[model samples]
Target chain A: MPRWFYQLASPRWCYQITGKLLPGFAIAALLLIAVGTVWGLAFAPPDYQQGNSFRIIYLHVPTAYMAQSIYMTMAIAGAVGLIWKMKMADMVLKCCAPIGAWLAVLALATGAIWGKPTWGSWWVWDARLTSMLILLFLYLGVIALNSAIESESTAAQATAVLVLVGLVNIPIIKYSVDWWNTLHQPATFKVTEKPAMPVEMWMPLLLMVIGFYAFFAVALMLRLRNEILRRERRAGWVRELLQQQRG
Target chain B: MNNKATNACHLPELKSGEISFQPGRIFWATLVRELNLALRRRSDLINPLVFFLMVATLFPLGVSPEPSVLSTLAPGVVWVAALLATLLSLDSLFRSDFDDGSLEQMLLSPQPLFVVVLGKVLAHWLLTGLPLTLMAPLLAVMLFLPAEGMWGLMLSLLLGTPTLSLIGAIGAALTVGLRKGGVLLSLLVLPLYIPVLIFGTAAVEAAVTGLPLGGFLALLGALLAAGLALSPLAIAAGLRISVSG
Candidate 1:
């Protein structure tokens, strides 16, 4: 392993690095999201068919993407924690669950808002939407499992195992859900599956996606920093750091 | 002393510094022990079957009981009921062993934990899922499911519930150390159960509509194969974590 890889196992080092990286991510997230929201809502040309109601995609797409990506990241971090006994990885996994769950919720809520105008309902049994809902449940399961256990490390390890199981099921769930939806109702329109879009539309979408990722990094680092302090409160460096902060 | 020496000379030679490990023996022992224990608790054996029947009955009573309406809902209703029944029985998969400390002994034994876990899960399927599959045909008839769909329901349940048992074992093992795990176990396992539920119902629907049911059954089989290949490892890992904690 590389030197930094080994260093990551040390909670003190992880806390220090997250502290260093937080400001950069926060700034980038703030600037990009502000710009992306303004541009997507006002400046971006309306869809030829659905008009301005499509602006919700700016929020929905990014959050939906982040929801799934954060899950994958959590599962990977879980695997790393389980395999290598990395406390930092466990912390990362723990912090990712709520953020991911909220993002899944945001994605679903935004999709509903967008759906009312386009699909003419607050909710539809659309494949992507249904799978997104399942993803949210998966996140809730992880959170519930983690909270149910009293011992922190045991909770982390057990939820890691569950996360991995969820990881393996995700693709299977997605495929089966798609099959089920098609069997019941053939989709007439695919909102996100437009073959081509002019640059004016996609650019903001790209910016929003990047901003969401940066925002996730900011959120994760913030939570992970607190988690490190909480888990390592009895360590000597944590005591020194607290004293330093107090002074 | 002379007679003892003659008897020892007649005995088979044993290898020194070599440990004997028989996974087959451990697997059978765990399976038989789990089966015997489950059979001894008649309510544990029968309650899920009753729940399966009651839940299946609920749809007809709760919804319109007309044959057309019941037939339309039958596939999903039967599959969902079976799924819940399996989940209901999963809490006991590791609870008794964990409570009595044999779980720790199983972990410490010379046998591979994977085989041991698989044996327990197989035993779980036989006790809970197998009974649910057998009773499903009655529920199908009660729900007004078509005659053609009966085979599909039975076949799908037969193939799908084992996978459900396998996956549910992971949740059960993970939560075995907790005091209140029943509701949490459902929350954890149900999402994973969705795919099987989807495919299983789809197969029944196809059969009802006279479409070929090969593809959905194939998918269910694939899931069972994947579960067999992978879930034992997860169950074993969860068991270890729970036991150690």
Candidate 2:
């Protein structure tokens, strides 16, 4: 095992290391997301059924995917923090909440926008939408709990417990439409199903997913770095780093 | 002389530990103490009940008072209103104890903290949650909920409201120390409440249509079980943070 992985558990090490990685990840994320957006929006074949409006999938699907993924990441980070008492894990959990919530909001907005043309209504209590809305509320609850408390450590601990308890709803949200007969269409992106589109369509989608992941990585690194600096501002090393930046 | 002193000290230590660790006595005593405190505050007991009645009354003003229409809307309105009333009651759950130093005393007690927390949650359920459950029939009558669905509605509330109290405890515990915590408490607990709302409302709806109540009741029971087992642990943890912070 690399000593640096454990060493990065220290906020100072995370501050320095992620600083070096940030620009590289930011550039890569921007390049890939741009290429993916263009390729998916302009070049990909329109759906035979939904037509050009299907292009919103490029933005909607990736964010929806990220929304769920980020919650899982938050939960895991919370679990690690609780079990190991790792400060870095708590930082990761804290950083993930707002990003995850924003991603959920984006997914909901884009989904609603896409729904207007396709489903004839802007909103419905369909399982998929309802579940996603619930996910948004869960994110909000975590953020609310974190902010309600005066002490950071206590807020983190309280939020961690809420995250763990709320995790039961995640599987329910993911499967509710599947288990019950519902107006919402079933899962479209199943790996086992034969491809419904030419490579031209799915290739860009694949790219978009990868791009979104990279974008999240870049954003997380930046936020994590800032969190480290703010948290460690009283430390001599932070003062030195700030002075160096100023110089 | 030294032997007498040692025996006397050891005897007191052993007796104290044994008495405090008696789970049954500790649980009931904590529960009783919380109930006593809640009752001693007349406003706390009366406020949630009044809120429940007022919310139930608003439906008639907002919607048509035609019996059929009111009956159709009754279960949902009553349940939603009860949920809100529970949220109102939750605002005071930890705030008073936290302010008056009772919470610190509870924490420093020899009893296990989880049991004490559980007792507080149970007392909260009795004061806020149970009253709502018991009052459902009266509200249902006012709202024109069908007579047939009455038992199932009551049953659902009986089973489901405790889950609400338990889940709400975590939010209450978290926000206990915040200024103007009422709105924040609702925001924190309402989303976590979706499952209970779904199942609880569904149970009453199912009964109105003469659908089997078995499945819906089972779901409510399962939720109660899950909440009962897990929420105290979360509340206990939250209380520690809120108190210590």
Candidate 3:
């Protein structure tokens, strides 16, 4: 294994690395998100179709994308942990669940909030929205299963299997839903098939997506550092770190 | 992970620690064992079907009883009820074996765990999925589903329910080790269930509208084929996880 990859296997090493990286990510996330929100909300030209309501996509699209991306990350992390017996990978898997779930919620809430103004209904079984709801359920299931299991290793492995299974279904769910939508013709608007968009509208959306990814990194590192501290509290390095902190 | 590196240092010997048995015979034996178990406990066979019936019954009472209304909703109501019923039966898929310690034995078997897992899943589908497929038409009738749609309902369930059984076995394998696994099982399985439900209901709706129903059924069939090939491996992986822990 390469030096960096090998180093990542150590919880203490991981904790230290994340500690160093967290601040950089945190600052970047804050600046970018603030810029993106202000730019998208205030400056971007309103859609010719939906007018002002379309601005919510800056929040909705990125969070929705992150919601799916984070779950995929958890699955990959889990496979690495299960296959390589990498302890830190399990930490990644466990720490990301609640963050991913809430991202799904934020995406759903923002989508619904946006929907009321755009679609004249708070919720519609639009394919994308319905799939997001199911994603939330999948995240909650992993969380619920983890909490239900008594042994930490057992929980990790079980949730790993589940995350993997859910990963496989994501594509199937997406395709089936697209097919169903075409069959049912339930569209209030076909926003999915957007033609060429002006760069001004898309630029802030790009910033928000990047910002969300950075924020996810910061959030994951924070939770994982806490997990490492609690799980490895009995280790000599943790004790040494605490003493160093006290000094 | 390498099986050798599972840190599974404790290799409990099976009653008959033989791996030389033919795969077909081993599969047959496992299937027969599960069948016998399901037969002995009649409720395992009946309860889910009963639940399917009752849930389907509630929609009519809960919603409008107009035949036109019921007919339009029949495809969805019946499919959802069938989906939930299969989920109800999935909780016990690996529980009995785990509790009796046979799951550990199966894991350590010279026979590939995938084959044994597939046999058990096959038995599961036969006991639950097959019966539900048969029972669906009755529910369709009760829901006032158009006669034209009856064949679609039956065929879709026939093809689709086994996919549910296969996909759900992964959830069952993962959760079989937990104490309160019932609700969690549904939570884990239902998202995966969406595609199957969508196509199954779509097939029936297509039939109701006199559209070409073959396309939706073909999709459902494709799903079943994929489920059969891949899901046992996932179920095997899940069983290994629970067993290792």
| Candidate 1 residue lDDT tens string, A1-247 | 8999999998888888888999999999999999999999999999889999989989988998899899999999999999998888888999999999999999999988988888788988766777888899999999999888989889999999999999986675446446545422332225677537687887888899899999999999999989888988999999999899899
**What RMSD, rounded to one decimal, does every model reach?**
5.5, 5.1, 5.3
Residue lDDT tens for model 1, B119-193: 989999998888889899899999899999999999999999999999999999999999999999999999899
TM-score of each: 0.93, 0.92, 0.92
Cα lDDT, all candidates: 0.88, 0.84, 0.86
Candidate 2 TM-score over all chains jointly: 0.92
Q: Report the lDDT tens digits of candidate 3 across residue range A160-234.
A: 888987897677445645664532223222468653668788888888989999999999999999999999999
- A1-28 per-residue lDDT for model 2 (tens digits): 5886588579998887887888888888
lDDT per residue (tens digit) for residues B176-206 in model 2 = 8788778878887888898888888889999
Q: Which docking band does candidate 2 fall into?
A: medium
- Candidate 3 achieves a global lDDT of 0.86
Poorly placed runs, candidate 3 (over 4 Å): A173-195, B1-18
Q: Which ten residues in a row have the lowest lDDT in candidate 3 chain A?
A: A181-190
Listed for every candidate in order, the interface RMSD values in angstroms are 0.6, 1.3, 1.2
* DockQ scores of all models, one per candidate: 0.78, 0.60, 0.72
Docking class of 1: medium
